[model samples]
Target chain A: MSIEVENIHKQFGSFTALNDVTLSIPSGELVALLGPSGSGKTTLLRIIAGLERADSGRILFNGEDTTEHHVRERKVGFVFQHYALFKHMTVFDNVAFGLNVRPRGTRPSKSEINAKVMDLLRLVQLEGLAQRYPAQLSGGQRQRIALARALAVEPQVLLLDEPFGALDAQVRAELRRWLRKLHDEIHVTSVFVTHDQEEALEVADRIVVMNKGRIEQAGTPDLVYDHPANPFVLNFLGNVNLFHGRLNQPGADQHGADENAVSYVRSHDIEIERSPQDSTALKAEIRHIQKLGPSVRVTLAIDATGEFIEAELTRDVFKNLGLQQSEQVYVRPRQVRVFVEDYQI
Target chain B: MSAPTTTYAAKANDNHRITEPALVRWGLTVVALVFLAMFLVLPLAAVFSQAFEKGLDVYLTALKEPDTLSSIKLTLITAAVAVPLNLVFGVMAAWAIAKFTFPGKNLLITLIDLPFSVSPVISGLIFVLLFGRQGWLGPWLDAHDTKIVFAVPGIILATIFVTFPFIARELIPLMEAQGRDEEEAALVLGASGLQTFFRVTLPNIKWGIIYGVILCNARAMGEFGAVSVVSGHIRGSTNTVPLHVEILYNEYNYTAAFAVASLLAFLALITLVVKTVAEWKVRQQLGR
Candidate 1:
């Protein structure tokens, strides 16, 4: 199933949750609505699921309008951030809830329902916990069971709102990979909302970056990360050292930035070396050096400007430099991207 | 004195006591226990002791009186009518307050708690002033040959007003803490509003519902001030249990009055037991 949202606008009192947002997800693609908190990613997902109503917009499932539809009629499986599993129901019963609530004529027989629930439980790898209540299970197990319950009705679209947000770091990482494999096998039109950029990049096939209730950029992970549309997208994706001075300065590489625009250079794009007698690289003194496992991050202050910028180098290369704190060195950017407009970090 | 003070400090250090000294602690404990005995336990024991003061036979005869039996029946009827109605209203109001946002929500909650802050006699009078013979709607009711004030309907109305807040008060905090996530999940899973309430929401708050009902029922049966005003003390007709107790005590029928009062006390004891069980059930569910 394909999901389409057109001209959606939602307001909470004076605050705008989504501002004329439009998005279209093709069938069988795992897309992520990625943004920081209050960026309207969750609001868009809820509107798509019919859990929330847009002020004026149309939601279409496979090109059929479903804007007026109730959440139950939308046939979109939604998983909540907190894994809102029914606390009083057993895992099997929770998974079987949708089927059990169906009208008698359309409802499956008891045996068929039982089999289907058990099969879904197995798919989530929680078949052994069929009889256990939700509180008895670990956080990861509870979330998997939540997903299985959502899948029991065979929804046309799967929507998850920070499905692993409540889990610890290790469990979150494990589930991120597991969800990617699960999506491949199931191939539902899945759209998951997440603020964790790494999770979105690693798990989603396409990423929609939203900021301040608007879609800033949407594309495959590599495209958005490498060729961001604006400064917000660039800064949001990863660490970047921003420069406000005019371009063509000493040791500054302007790949796309014009002379007057602000420059943004990735931390790893910086090169540090001892100044040769003839070198024209920007003169700087290393202020601080942090040795991460694979790379060393050195904070350098430019002599001409007294501004601090970070440079990253692999451990082997950094070791060859024999750098010490407060040692004088020259720095140069290898690649720089600049946007014309100003945006606060 | 210095030696004793040193010993007290040593004991405080031994226990890592952050509270007051042993003298103050023991004094406060003794005071509270004595207060409980004076106010709660003694009065409760007096009700039973006075009832049986004459003899077991006299006590039995007093309860077996026609007026006493009728009052008991009337109290039961009032509770039966008032509690279920409040339960429905309480659940609906709590659902609206806890789950959704709208205008005047805080006002509605304040109005729901109006009975608790207002005097019970005034609560009864408000209904009377609207339904009494000379009240706002009194002439209209009189024209239709209907009676409300100082009647069974008025008694039931008064009881309902005082006890309605109990269930809603118990449920709002519970539902607010529980959040609407589970209910929203149920709706997304294809369950209808009614189905979600029954299957997911009701089961989760079943113990809370029971706890509120027990408290409400106890209040409904034992209400004195509100029912006293609305009930015209028409013995064997409109007299509820508390009204009958007042009538007996006023007429110097001390034995009968305490006998009837003992019955209400017994109901209260039973309510306490049931309430404790419900609270335990809530704890167990939450512990899960």
Candidate 2:
């Protein structure tokens, strides 16, 4: 099943949580609503799940309006950030809750529920912990159990609000990978809300970046990252060096590529050398050097503008150059992207 | 050098400890114990001691009196009617207050504690003004041939008025701390609204509800000021145990009055035990 949200607007008192937001998801695709706190990603996800009502808009499930439907009538699965597992219930019963709460005509038999719940437990690799209550499990274990519970009902759509937001760093990374693999295996239409950009880039098939209750951009991960439509998306995606320099060279305005006054450049796109023969090259001084595992980052300040920028170099290249702090260097922009003043969302 | 350093460390450790001096600790303990003995233990012991003053046979006869037995029944009935009604109203009010936002929310919360701020006598008098024979509703009730004042209904209403805030006050903070995340999760999982409440919300706050009910029921059975104003001191029908005790004492029936007073004290003791157990259960649930 596919899901569509159109012109959704939600407000809490005078605060606008979502503003004229619209998006559509194809069947079996994993989409992410990515933004900072108070950016309304979670509110938009809740509206799609029918847990929250929109101020004015419609939600469609395969082209049929479900705006006025009750949450229980939506047939959607929702997972919370804090893992709202039933503390009074054992893990086995928590997973079986959806099946047990079904109406009499469609309810499964007792043995069938047991088998299905056990199967879900095994799927989450928590079959051994089935008899344990939620309080007895670790945070990672509880979240995994919550996911298994959300999946038990065979929902047509799945919504997760920061599913890994509460886990520690190590467990969060592990669960992120596990969730991606699980989605590939199940392939149900899914939308997850997260503020972690790396998670959106790594796990989601499509990323919708939001800012101040507005959709900044929505596209494939690389499309939104490499070809961000506006400055907000570019700055929010990752580390980048921004500049506004004049370039009167031949194709500065002709070719679509190098329309120099390169508005922004990624850190890796900034190239540094000991010396350059070209007059157009910018002169800079190295301020600091940080050696990461396989790459070294050189922080430099432009001698002319006093502006700072970062250039990432391979370990092999850095060793060959023998660069040091306080050293004079020439820098060049290897790749450039422009964010126009008249940009539209 | 090492010896001097060790001695200095020991002196610093003594200063670091937060323990009070022996003299101060003992003084505070003695003061508290003296006050408890003077104000609490002695009065409770006197109730039992005076009941047995006329010998075991006389105590037994006082308890067996039909007036005393009927008063006990009336007290139990008042609590039986009042406690459950307040329990339902308290849970609904707490749920609405803690989980939803609407106009006059702060006003509603302050009003829930209205009975607590108002004197029990005034609470009883308010009902009397509404339903008594010479009051506003008196003429309408007389035409309908219905009697509310000086009746069991009036007694129950007064008891309920004084105890209504107990459960709601207890549950509000607890339900607030445990946000509505679980309820929303249940709803998205296809559980109906009623199912979500019974399965999720009620189970989460069950211990709090029990603790509140114990306190409310204890107060309902022991209420004197409110029930006295409305009950009119009828012999059998409207005389609760507290009112009966007062009447017997006024008539110089000391032995019978003390006998019933001891029973009320026993009820208080049982209430403390159950309240503590329920509180401990709540602590354990939260600790998890």
Candidate 3:
């Protein structure tokens, strides 16, 4: 199903959780709502699922207005962050719940319900544990069961709120790969909320970065990572070294040469050398050096501004240049994205 | 002087041992056993011993009396009516209080627990004031020719009033702890509101409901102070088992009185057993 959320707003007492947010999701695409805590990503997902009512908004599912639909009528599958499985139900029964609870006229036969539940359990790779209760399963297994149960309804859209948020780091990685594979097989329109940027980038076809109840950027993972729309997206996606200074060169774009312009360069973007041959090269002193696998992380303290920046170099390059701690060096930016300081808020 | 200091140090080391002395442990155990015997064991023994004092046949005969039989029937009927009514109220109240947030929620909870703090006799008296001839709503009730103040209905009302909080008190904490996530999941999965309640909410809280119902049933059957005030001691009609026991005791028929009291005690024992089982089931369901 294609979902279009138009100007959604939500508030809890004095705090505004979501503010005039709009997003459109195409059919059979997996999108990730990526943000830090209290960023309103989960709130937006819940609004789409009809679990929460937006103070003012219109939600259209495949050209049908679903804002007035009850949660039962929405036909949206929602998986909670905590794997909210029924504690008293067996895995099979939990997966069969939607089929069994269908209104009598449209309800499936008993044999069909059994076969469908078994198929779902197998799809989640939990067919052998159908008799086990949720409490008996590991956190990862319970999460898959929650997914299978959500899928049993044959929903138009699937929504998950931090689907792997509660698992350990190792399990989280495995589940991300597994979820991507599962999405490929089902090809359902799916949205999942996540705080882990790596998980979002690895699993989702598209990422919507949010902060402070607003969408900072939305694009393919590569687009959002390489071309962040603002400072928040830049800082949130990956590690960066920020240089706060005035633009010295003239005839730049009108918006690019402000006195408070901040230049952001990824760690790998800074070129380091022993001699200052280029006019753009800034003098710096090497503060620290650490061997990180095949790369050497060099922390440089620029002499002109007394500001610190990091450069990641291959070990072979470091050895060829004979670099060492407390050594003097010249640093030049290979690439940088500059933004005004006023863009923070 | 050095020898004396060394010996004194050894004695101090003995006193500073981590575990308590064996004699103190034994002494504490003996004291706890004595306390238990005095408070629990003695009273239970007294009840059973005094109950069979005359003879088995005579004790059985007392229970077989028409008035005694009628009192037992009255108690059963009261519990049958009161327990189910309160069970329904308990489920509804717990659902409303735990699953949703609304204005005046705390006030509603406090009102539900009002009977716990009020005296049982006062509970009966409140009902009496509402239904009695000289009290509020009395003239209308009189004109309608409904006899509630000194009848079976009055007894049932008093019993219900006193036991109203038992099931709800057991349920509120349990339901609140279980939370609303499962119900929401069910609803999102295309289950109707009623279906979600039955399939998700009710199953999760089944043990709590059973635990509450047993306690409610016990209180409904054994209530004395409230029932006595409202019953007016109508022989074979309004007197419950507890009231009948009081009547027999007041008349100096100690054996018969104790015999009737034993039945109430037996009912209490059954309730205790069921409560233990229910608690165990709840623990199992919670995966504790």
The most accurate candidate by TM-score is: 1
Candidate that beats the other on DockQ, 2 or 3, i.e. the better one = 2
- What DockQ was computed for model 1? 0.75
Quick one: best lDDT, which candidate? 1
lDDT of 3 by residue, B96-201 (tens): 9999999999998999999999999899899889999887988998999998999999999888889888888888888788778888988888888888888888
> Where does model 2 sit among the CAPRI classes?
medium
**TM-score for each predicted model, relative to the true structure:** 0.94, 0.92, 0.90
B1-288 in candidate 2: lDDT tens per residue?
799999999998887687788799899999999999999999999999999999989998998999999999999999999999999999999999988888999999999999999999999999899999888999999999887789999999999999999999999998898888889888888888899899999999999999999999999999999889999888988999999999999999999899989999999999999999999998887777
Worst 10 residues of 3 chain B by lDDT: B279-288
Better of 1 and 2 by lDDT: 1
Supply candidate 2's per-residue lDDT for A31: 95
Candidate 1's displacement at residue A108, Å, is: 0.9
Candidate RMSDs in Å, in order, are 4.2, 3.7, 5.7
Q: Which stretches of candidate 1 lie over 4 Å from their true place?
A: A246-260, A276-280, A291-294, B1-20, B284-288
Can you give the DockQ of every candidate in the order shown? 0.75, 0.74, 0.64
